[model samples]
Target: MNFYAIKAIYLFEMSRTFRTITQSLLAPVISTILYFVVFGSAIGSKIQTIEGISYGVFIVPGLVMLSVLMQSITNASFAIYFPKFIGTINELLSAPVSTLDIIIGYIGAAATKSFSIGILILLTAHLFVPLNIIHPFYMISFLLLTCFTFCLFGFIIGLWAKNFEQLNLVPMLIITPLVFLGGSFYSISMLPLFWQKLSMFNPVVYLISGFRWTFFNVSDFSFTISLIATISFATLCLIIIFYMFKTSYKIRT
Candidate 1:
């Protein structure tokens, strides 16, 4: 099914990342190390623990999730958006490739980048505190699904964007805030009852909660709910991408 075409696009996108490794990889690594320093060292020493896990270790999942979410969006959005911005998108569109091949190429590369960052952050996290992964299978599952889902979400943003400002809009304004408020740094149970109830409305909460569960076996929501939520979100993204390609949304422009 046009495997060579898909490989060509995928490798090209990946090569761009290597070319910009300092910006694409090192930046996130340095930022995460800073988070580890400030939150894990300074604050963690004062707080001691959350739900019986050391605060440093407890924050690992959230920290990784934060970076994954941001990078997934940033990478995918920029990859597709740059083509649109520079008028190369029309060339790709007219090429002998199916929509699925194009999506697999772009989103696959983006997902791989985000996935690498996730694993990198995980290894970096170990320098600050000893960590335990209670459920390794579930942890990888959550990470894989999260990378793919958010990469697809970023693809949608890339397609819908009309300018650089519009391109950065969702990841900066919407996603980052949702993650902060979504119990990324703290447990929802620490919130008052009202805020706890309200937090459920934020979809990022389930993602962080479920990922956290795999690490320490502690969660704000049921693991089943988190699994279901992630699957549903990915499915929804797939549907929307298909519709956009079918309608040539923004691409025909």
Candidate 2:
């Protein structure tokens, strides 16, 4: 399975993360802490609770999901895009590793980083407000699933991008907005009925809802539906990536 080749690539990516520890790790953690300060401390003191859960506690899962999604995409996309930008991708391509091995290496490393950030954020949240994990198993399951899925999606972005601008385009313009509107800080049920219905079209809502459910046993959609939506999105990303790799899209050109 070319384990050595995969290990080399994996270690290289992980080492890069360590080298840029401030931007790669601390930045997201600090951002999340700020969110807790602004939203949890300032705003939460005014509002009593959302669905009987303290406003601060209610937002924990969403905040974690937000950070995880952004970091996973950023980490994976940059990891591969840098290679393409600097013309080192050809060297990796020339290596004996198969496509699956290469993907496992890069995506695995990115997911690990994002997963670590998610856990760190969760621990950080405990300092601000008490937390009760209704389903610990499901919580970890959702966190791992979200990390791997978004990392794969980011891998696709890396492959499709041609420049630095294009690499940052999707996560900044598209993903950030989705996470904000996806009930990260407030419940979708609190929205106007019309907006609530419209929010259903946003895929990020399902992810946040499902993750929040694991914490509070409450969600905008059924757990089964959220699970299905998440898997469906992951599958779609996989199909798109497969086509790109087969066509050598934005690569070997």
Candidate 3:
């Protein structure tokens, strides 16, 4: 792997992000504020506290996760997809850059963008509700882990997608719906026993619950279980992504 090549790719990607900084960063922040205003202030007043934390505060982790999840996916997908669209991907492929270098370059930028946005959203939430971090280390760890895993998953989506419409399909359709139904705004305890069992199938539930535990020191499920699920899911996603990269699936004939 060439150091110069890696640096070139990273700097180029970062430049592209800078060109549209407002849409990438500020728009997400604005949407997050709207959520705080509408849901936290308007709807939450009618709801009681969860684990001694106000409904608004309880939703903070989920909001952070939402920001990280979307940013990671969109950043990674667009990074690769645009190269393919502009005929630059073939140049990189034919260049001396190894596939590992390519993956690291793209995923690193995506994670960085996602992490920055996640923290920004958390900071923005501070204006609306005072948040308490019962476990700061765990909170940061989960946030990074979530960002890394989704970035890898998005890379796979980028490689597999054949067009712009296909690229946005998974995030807009699958990921968004999963997050909403994953108890981001509500607790599964409010659900009946049957629905509670069903909710377990949604992987985002573990992520949201784990993040909530970091803030309130209370969780719907064991914190250890969430850690294990996150680790396992990330590992599986990495394996699949590595395989795709190694095989050059959908990248070459």
Candidate 4:
């Protein structure tokens, strides 16, 4: 692989993110605040604790995960889309860069953006509410892993998208709904037996469960199970992305 080419692509994409750093950082933070105010103050009283933590505290991981996931998808999608929009994707394909190099360059940029925003939101949360991360390493690791996995998923979305409207459809239509229903605001235990079982089908549930577990040292699913689910989704995303790049699905015509 051409290391120089990879760095060039990665650095260029990173610079693009910096151009809109204010928007990127603030948007998620603001949205997180809205969630906290509405859910924490208004509804938290009605709901009780999960795993010995307040409802507000329990939901933090899910909110953070939602932010990380959305940022990864949008950042990676834009990174891929800019080249197509500016007619540079053809040049990139013709360049000597390997597919792996291209994939890593874009995915790294996406993960970086997501990580930055995730940390910023956490910092913001500290001001309005207190949080505890019992196992710091596990917390950071899971967050980073989720960012990487979703970054790859974003690349696939970028490759599949032909226009700007199509670009946001997946994140808005599919991912957003999944996050809301993924037990971000409420624990699965609060659901009826049937809905509790049904909630298991949503992948984001595992992500939240694992993240919250790191905070309080308690989780609905075992940490091992959560890690396996994350790895599984990531592997599936990698395979799909590889196939898309190999065929140049919407990338090359």
Candidate 5:
């Protein structure tokens, strides 16, 4: 409803992204290139393909997902956390903006950054390996969903965090590890049966698996289950965000 308020917050966050171009964009681009170099050259040699796709190409979806997830969280979390850290959140709170406006502004900007990096990375992947999208619609659907979901999740992290260190905690310690173990570099099928069973417990696996399927029509789990898991997780994040705003959890403190 408050279009101007949303636009102002969105543009402000976008400007901040441009200001930190090196860290926000270039850093992830460089890191993804390194991953391609190391994994594509070294591991890709021993393993030519997984699920009938070349090892280098097979990992592209997962790599993009990994970068997008981390970027979304990092950007959104830092964007809000900085304002809170510097005591400017109160300014926004006092403004004529609804919680919906604020969340949409921040979350939209964060998702845009994350998704932009993801598209760039996808283009960058073409340089290292030939790629194809068997299902463009499915691919974009999953891409948008993942970007929006994680960005919202990151917004929640921003609200819950009390300091810079805490802002970095989940992405560094939890999300990143989940992604690596979630079949970013290799398929879960390559794991031992016991480890395979355990891998099912990791939620990131479903996301990566489902996204990978859109590319090669291959997945570690059922496509339906992956879709369900992703929607379920996003729903949970949305619920938490509503509760946080309604109760003023950490927002008024």
Candidate 6:
């Protein structure tokens, strides 16, 4: 339905990405390489293996997840927030596109960008460390789900934000901290028992754990739990977005 409308919006967003190639794509890739240099060289030397996987290799999934999560949120939030900031959202609102169509256009483009970044980072990882993927199917599944879910969450952020500062608030303050503490650089098992239990409450842990499991069949939580948590979070974001669009929250005004 309204395929043409979706295509126009999608193309517009994609073109903007190309225009900002340095920031949108290259920046994250460069940052990830730095992480490899610092963590893989300095820290990886001290800690040889976590669950029998080399420290450098062990962190690959986490690093990719970190980049993907942040980029997904950044891309989606900015895509819609720019429209709101410049007063062009009203034009899109008046278009014949349904809410789903609009969401698909924006969210799809954002997810695609993040997904491409994920693939690029994975390929880049090979240059630094020898890597192995035990279950490629599950790895791709988790990557796709994470991209779509976070992009949707970012879209919600775009809608709720009234200013630029507010737009950066969640990803920088909340999500970024959660990721670092969520076992991105080390396993939660390395934590003391109490902290290990406490780590369970941080949602990003499950995401990184589940993705790591796909690579080495190792994780802080059960694979089943991780999958459920990922899907549940996605579903929750979808519900909130549906309600927002239906009520015209921050869109109609």
lDDT assessment of candidate 5: 0.90
- Across 51-165, the per-residue lDDT of candidate 2 in tens digits comes to 9999999999999999999999999999899999888999987888777787889989999999999999998998888999998999999899899899999999999887889
What are the Cα lDDT values of the candidates?
0.93, 0.91, 0.88, 0.88, 0.90, 0.93
The local lDDT score (0 to 100) that residue 185 gets in candidate 3 is: 89
* Pairs in steric clash, model 6: none
Deviation in angstroms for 124 in model 5? 0.7
What TM-score, over all chains together, does every model reach?
0.98, 0.97, 0.96, 0.96, 0.97, 0.98
Clashing pairs in 4: none
Q: Residue-wise lDDT of candidate 5 within 126-240, one digit each (tens)?
A: 8999998888899888998899899989989999998888898999999999999999988999999999999999999999999998898888888789888888888899899
Clash pairs (backbone) in predicted model 1: none
| Model 5 pairs whose backbones collide | none
Give per-residue lDDT, candidate 3, residue 220: 87
Span of 10 residues, lowest total lDDT, candidate 1: 20-29
lDDT tens string, model 4, 1-253? Answer: 8888879988998887789888878889899999889998789878888767888887888889989999999999888887898899988999998888988888987898899888888887777778878999999998999999999888888888889999999999999999999988878888999989998998988988898888888777898999999999999989998888788777788
lDDT of 6: 0.93
Q: Between candidates 1 and 5, name the one with more favorable lDDT.
A: 1
In lDDT terms, which candidate is top? 6
Error of 6 at 241 (Å): 0.9
**lDDT by residue (tens digit), candidate 6, 144-199:** 99999999999999999999999999999999999999999999989999999888
lDDT of 3 by residue, 1-253 (tens): 7888888888888888899898888998999999998889899899888667789998888888887888899999888988888888988889898777887788888888898899999999998999889899999988988888898889888888899999999999999988988888888898899989999999999989998898888888888899999899888877887788688788877
Stretches of candidate 5 off by over 4 Å are: none
Q: Over 4 Å off in model 3, which ranges?
A: none
